[model samples]
Target: MGITREIGAHYVQEKGTTFTFWAPDAEQAEVVLHVNSKQTIPLQREAFGYWVGLAEDAKPGTRYTFKLDNDKEFPDPASQSQPDGVHEASEVISHTYNWTDQNWKNLPLEEYIIYELHVGTFSEEGTFEGIINKLPELKDLGITAIELMPIAQFPGERNWGYDGVYPFAAQNSYGGPEGLKKLVDACHKAGIAVVLDVVYNHLGPEGNYTSSFGPYFTEKYNTPWGAALNFDDAHSDHVRNFFIQNALMWLRDFKIDALRLDAVHAILDTGAKHFLQELQEHVNHLEQQLHKPFYLIAESDLNDVRLINPIENGGYGLAAQWMDDYHHAIHTVTTGETDGYYSDFGKPEHLVKTLKHSFIYNGMYSEYRKRTIGTDATANPAKQFVVCSQNHDQVGNRMLGERLTKLVSFEMLKPIAALVILSPYTPMLFMGEEYGEENPFQFFVSHSDKDLVEAVRKGRKEEFASFAWQGEAPDPQSEETFNNSKLQHSYTESEKQNQLRKFYKELIQLRKSVLKKLCKEQLEATLNEEETVLQFTHTSAGLRCVINFSDQPQTITGTQGWQLVLNSADTKWGGPGSDNYTSGVITLQPESVLVLQAKA
Candidate 1:
């Protein structure tokens, strides 16, 4: 008989419960149940290194552990709930949930205005329930989708969710599996889609006992987080299935609309069928089975077009990928910071090129990397690239985790928002960016191991050595660092913040109402001779936007028979009044943007 059961603990109404584990190197395996009393059930060794057994009394809410060859006990590698912690026993969780989003279909990729947020810091409660309370506010901001950072089970009560050791288990501190389902259900009811960020490149260093079961890691390649996952090495098929199943659990069980794969550049594989291609194939099958649309987006440093290309075109066929060049070009031009990777940027023409073409360095020489980088992504559709001015990595990776609000002027912030939202691509916003929350999104952790805590502190300091940032990097192990990163949500009280929030809402509404119907191919961008002014026009919509990037007023010619629609320098958005034009010659205010449309 073919086995179609799930890899971990699965409960069937008629079959009671069955425990399946993969321990190729072990001679014996048993499921140690911690129900009312200690009970043990021996598993029969099956083909291909799988051990299968049944515990008649095992049901949901039962805590259990696995023992191999009479050795030390360990939590299930595919555990669904690690309630106590990563080092403690795993609890059996039922995949059943009273979902109200049976009719919830995913929003089109072009209409996605994603708001990326960390669950632990997005609200004062710092739990899944807390995020549900703010859904109405997010909905009012014109946010179509909310992308959550990883929620996998990490070490302690606090983490950025990247140090997750348990790939399948939801964090116990974040109200566990039950809490996550409620958040997803609530988001769907509020007409918002949820995109979950997942890490598959490497597991955390602590409480990672998957190696005890089988060859889940390979020595053939090394990642910055240590050993790379065994994708193309020996016994790699099962390892690939393990993670592929994890992806399905989120989409199938949790009803997540999309998944953002973290750091795909670190996922190395040399096999004929690349891991990504295989994953895309499986996700496609799942989409058909579920009869609902699901997306897979990747966060890769490499500007490779193969990630979003069609499978028949010899590509991975992912839905989209994060475009960091858009952020870098805009950031460097606005901030005037030339340190580190910003060395290749800092020119106004760079942003203009990014606006016209999708990438600024498509097969061009990169001084930062000392080599030619990036493939030509000109043929890709605008929606295949997700652009953002500030994300977790761009803000939190800094020595002080200062956001753009702290670095740029108030007048400059509006133009930056205009550039991102009006650009011909899907836009994402970091948490607290709409109203410009001033708190720093610093890197933080709460590991119980003192040595690991110290190592993290030292590693953070060393990582910023190349940038030559001044003061000492904040200690990642400190609780104050975590507390300080929480969002204050004070936009309603402060005038400047409320104005900024209103400005963002208007831009988002304009994007949906005007830009959504326009053709991406009809977009045109040009830079003046001095490269201080950029003029972008959409021929299909008969709309034009001109931005001045310099501190002084810039003179630019406006199109004839065009009427002003919105101006960033208008006094309504807390800026100086808009400038006037004579005979089609307009003088733009310092660091301001003007939007105009051809009169009907």
Candidate 2:
């Protein structure tokens, strides 16, 4: 009955509904409701370019559209459900739900072991209900939180979700509003928090009609996708309210535990109060009102600590952010990839520096950008940075959409996993990385425009020029491409795959047990002369991890008091067993990780 009701259609029990629209530019605005009969209701213009109207005959399940100035009708920009598609009418939905997670409490930020997955490809069903069925398996896999790729309503049945046109609408193909609520409810029941990926930088090219109502986008600054969102332009007050309300809708109405803002670096805003800072302030108020924890994690390429820094320190006060440098350092080292951004990495010292300090490029000159980049983030806690060896962008953005399993050997994945899970920062895993999923998570879309489809394909091909990857990119508009990206889920049948899953589970168990009590200050990482051998010590836990990144085995010293806790190269983990320690010296197998603990 507050901000949610102020925008979009709000249905009142046994009392019909109230419809609102923001169309300052339009001379007229009317709600064309599709009920038992075609009903046209004119809305009364309100202050600050808003139109409000009450329809007693309209109730939940009523489909309608807003016609502006005798022009073509358009779906609600803040639509709760776009059942017919992005091009069709919007349906009225009730926010009421029988939530059983009243007593559900979220895990601390440090305790989050995030597993990021795309809903459409995560399961064969490819629905919210599909994810519900897999909740038990995820809970068992030591995943404390599941970060879903953007689920806002996109053009068609399939998309990576960055093309979402309706920011407030639940993707109709993914079971719409009711289905999303059910999945969130189920996740909480399984002791898993839900982190939703949201794109606030720019709307999709197709089916974007927000400009028809008012100045929703500005031509002043352009984004990689299109014109940047008008956060600091004229009529920006309503534009800011639109996105802020959308965030509130996800957290308040759907009960999402956290939001992973997609590409905040592209959100160009030159205002007194930054959009991110303002959004965080609103979320803080909601956290107080709900008496629960809700976090905002940003995906930013800028490498600025101001995003997670406290508001008192002239920062945004976000809980966490995705640190891409950590992934780049690890990927370049393990895969021997030195293309594009990876060229800035590949040195073993880069990974060592990343392990010690979350940002490898903190206030340093970046060879890739040919400019000084990043701010010092060493003052921030390790939990404020989410590190992953493989994520959606890293895997899918490749020319072939290849995962780490495709690029690196089976043995190499163990050390990469150890580096991410055992590191001081919060760790995240891409879907199927736990069990060595072989399927590629290719990018796919279902847009209606044929010309736009061709443009997208061309853009993707051109984007790979810098990486210099050979061959053509898979067709994004092809249904076969989307189908090819689905997880096989047959890891249980494969011996090696199941073993990899077991290895991951063991590492996660260790992280939750001994490593959980250790802070960033207690962690120290060092590299040998050739930089092929890497070792990190957890002083407080008396735990040590040694990794061999070279093709051949390497010997390392200073292990007299430590006993073997876990050996990834052991025969049990589907690897050739390495030689046991002798007289404080040990030979680490090629591409293997060793975990040791102080003997009692």
Candidate 3:
């Protein structure tokens, strides 16, 4: 009864290709194969509102569309390849590929040092092939996992990929489904697991035809993007199956080791079994069946510990959740920005609590939300929380999309890197953050609808008005804005950036090897509010990270036999050599950090 067998177009060499669609509301359905000699084949309606037929003329590379009610023609809702456009025919793609990762095993969640990158902006080429050529660079940089932003098909070539309308199809502009598979296969060969960001809460407004096919969305609840998905509605089984099948396709067909569900807080459902739990169960089944380790990381703003709690404990059983609290606490302190949600953070105590516990607001009053929020996540493993100093949303949603490199001094950036990589939680680095690329990650989209484009432009302006940020918002519709967001690959060629990259690689090496044993039980922190100096200790591991945020040299004493393992102020790490520590005291330069291993 699993819907994965034959939901989309599947090719059988002898029988050619068979197309299947779930259109319960349609009076009639047919397949319009857009080959040189166009052929229309009437699909026999099956039980449960499914229309199925064999197109003997259709094979891999054949373009086709579904005709509903004998009148309207639209691309398959479960399209795998939209080569022309979202509005055009869905191409039949062969899943066969020369994959050499049959013996590849993905790293466990605890070992993940994830590097999140948008395929379109990670390189100048902005394609899956472009990303393949850089796999060695990421592998050599010590990245265990690569998290790609949403790659589902949208309207045009330029998009952050959140506007994806075709959940199953790979963006035609990004070289379609085959391109994504090649990238995934290549990543596995390089010993890097791939975590794809998937949006299931709501579909984009443009080129969305799922509603016409069946009850795919519900008006009972609304999401920030649009109407919420039909998870609890009356004909919701197929709707759930639609998404379940999509997730399966990515995991089973593409061999992606993990999925990062975007904004789980936005997914509205009142069902007895929440869609998240159901999806988790499905993933679990796949893991057992395929004998592969899989993970599901949720991006939730609700601060609900239940999202990652065990399934037996009446929770969603997610592998991990994004620890935005850590980012907020770090960003507020380093940049001293107290606007928006940062107002809830910025205190040394706030960061200390986040380091000790996963969430600073666990069962505490939130002034920003004007209510008590979150539950204790301290009991969860440190790896259950994915922490990052900077990500796409934190930077792209800003007025000018200024990265951490733009917000803080070169000396300040290393401490930020150390705080994240050395933390107990799983660490994720935004693309180019390792080498300190100066280019901003501005939001850009290329929607074909003129009216929708204007609406997005206006909405962005109004959204930033509340942030109280200066300067005009960049045009999301402009080619220059998209180009500006692309990372400068040549930045690492410079002496300073090359050193920073080396620093990141060394930190990653220490994390995976020596620091692997670090746990919350071994954690401790000493905060000096007056000098803005924070000393965090891993007592059991005999490790300590001393950070100086003050603008002047600060002295910290009482370290008898601690050996300086790594220092951000070292000349090798783009710093004016170490300030030097002697006896039981160490002099820390302004805006520098030091990692010391206590001698046994």
Candidate 4:
């Protein structure tokens, strides 16, 4: 494990750095210098499945690729940095680069405003460098943090990144490891924190060779992706250390502020002390060392508050978790569809339950499952929950991958977005939701084997067959399907898009300005079922969110002294209002929401 430099390859490791690679398939490997082909170094292979090479010359910005068989140049399966496509060589990155945000250490989870963005669809170039162009755009729109989708190595030059092959390496297509550093550095300088979305539940299908190298997977625990990681089996310490170290690398070396672990519910670990709790403990130690506020957010569907509760209080001590119930309540009520898990939701009482308590399906009989399931979330506050109307999963799981912008009218979308930004918990916006991009975010893949591609096609079809979605599923392997899902950035120019954008910015700005008190305050909310209007009065001062769900205008009498802060009905955002509004009792139009600032 300590043999990186003897072979003359440009690799270096220090207190804050470690270089890794996998290549049992290669006879001999060399790191070819991009500047001069003559300057080459050989890599040393060890008993394990790894090849090691060390050279201090491997400074950040140095371009190189491993040469297999002393002939064909292929991207490093472990390449941390790739400024070009995966087929291209890797680039060296320096964490020693200048950082500007010395004062921006920690943003409390309770006070955070999360904006989720896909690097590819966010701009035309769709690279790490490409997103630098829009940093100010996000900051100007009142976003405090930018949560990026997965950026690890995948098969093609472009993908949704769930099917990643190299969990540690940056995506070769999106400007590799160095590209990521530049993006994070730029974000910190802009005073906007960067939160990374990391997939730890399962490794992607293509370019996967972890199993051949070591006891990386277990036959004991089976995951939907394949073999689950062996957390409890023999020689599991090293395997657990691998992922734990990866988490620390992102927070310390990459200068990442927080990590959002994807599909934590799928991580089937049965150790005495769960792996999540252990990982959290290690991260806390690292956080103390770095003296920075590092956060661990999990994507869980267990409906258990123990995941977020403090360990001293008998919980895992995570910062927050993605609130699936919040999405279920809003989506089922607005869309009026009760299929699958949505069947347990859509009831007005369910919406009220989700608002008052974090979990709606807490030990209750679910009509869809025909069983009582789920645990209570009473152990944590509202800050432990992340509320959202539409996320990548809810929108992409559909047969057509239709977004809220497509399923509902402009009026409906405005209110839905209002509900997201003005809610007590942290709010998440899908990439193009602020601009109302009508493009679908369908599932796409890039597998080299033709038969495997066909298998995926069939699997996708059968997945949706049981639900309401029935249609010709997009050929995941096809380039057309991938391109179809790529967001058309020009939609931000359309009137409806512009209005939604402005409304989002206003709502976000309002959240930043006036909702400071509610961030820490926990409260219950409800809707008058008979009036078809939903209302939330936060016991914590300064927030009251009211939405008109039915297709009729309803006025509230008792709600006086309230000034309209964010209205989706403004004409600029294509609302019915002839003139923009400043203050009034919510004359809520159909499918509209009003965010009012409580009287001081």
- The prediction achieving the highest lDDT against the true structure is 2
- Badly placed stretches (over 4 Å) of model 2 are 1-5
TM-score of 1: 0.98
Model 3 clash tally, residue pairs:
0
Worst 10 residues of 2 by lDDT: 1-10
Query: Residue-wise lDDT of candidate 3 within 484-518, one digit each (tens)?
Result: 99999764569998998999999899888777866
Q: How accurate is candidate 3 locally (lDDT)?
A: 0.89
Off by over 4 Å in 4: 1-79, 82-94, 519-524, 529-531, 570-573, 578-587
Q: Tally clashes: model 1.
A: 0
Candidate 4 lDDT (Cα, whole model)?
A: 0.73
Residues 108-130, candidate 4: write the lDDT tens digits. Answer: 77667788877776777888998
TM-score for model 2?
Answer: 0.98
Question: Where in model 1 is the C-alpha error above 4 Å?
Answer: 1-5, 518-520, 580-583
lDDT of 1 at 63: 94
Each candidate's TM vs. the true structure?
0.98, 0.98, 0.98, 0.87
How does residue 41 of candidate 4 score in lDDT? 73
Error of 4 at 27 (Å): 16
* Candidates in descending lDDT order: 2, 1, 3, 4
**lDDT string, candidate 1, 1-600, tens digits:** 111236889887656678988888899999999977889899999877899998878889889999999988999999999999999999988888899988898888888999999999999999999999999999999999999999999999889999998999889899899999999999999989999999989999889999999999999997898888999888888888888889989999999999999999999999898888888888899989988888999999889999999999999999999999999999988998888888888888787677767888899999999999899888889899999999999999999999999999988988899888988888999999999899999999989989988889889988887785788788898899999999999998999899889999999998988888544578888889988888888888788889998899988765678888888888888888875756577889999988888789
Regions more than 4 Å wrong, model 3:
1-6, 529-531
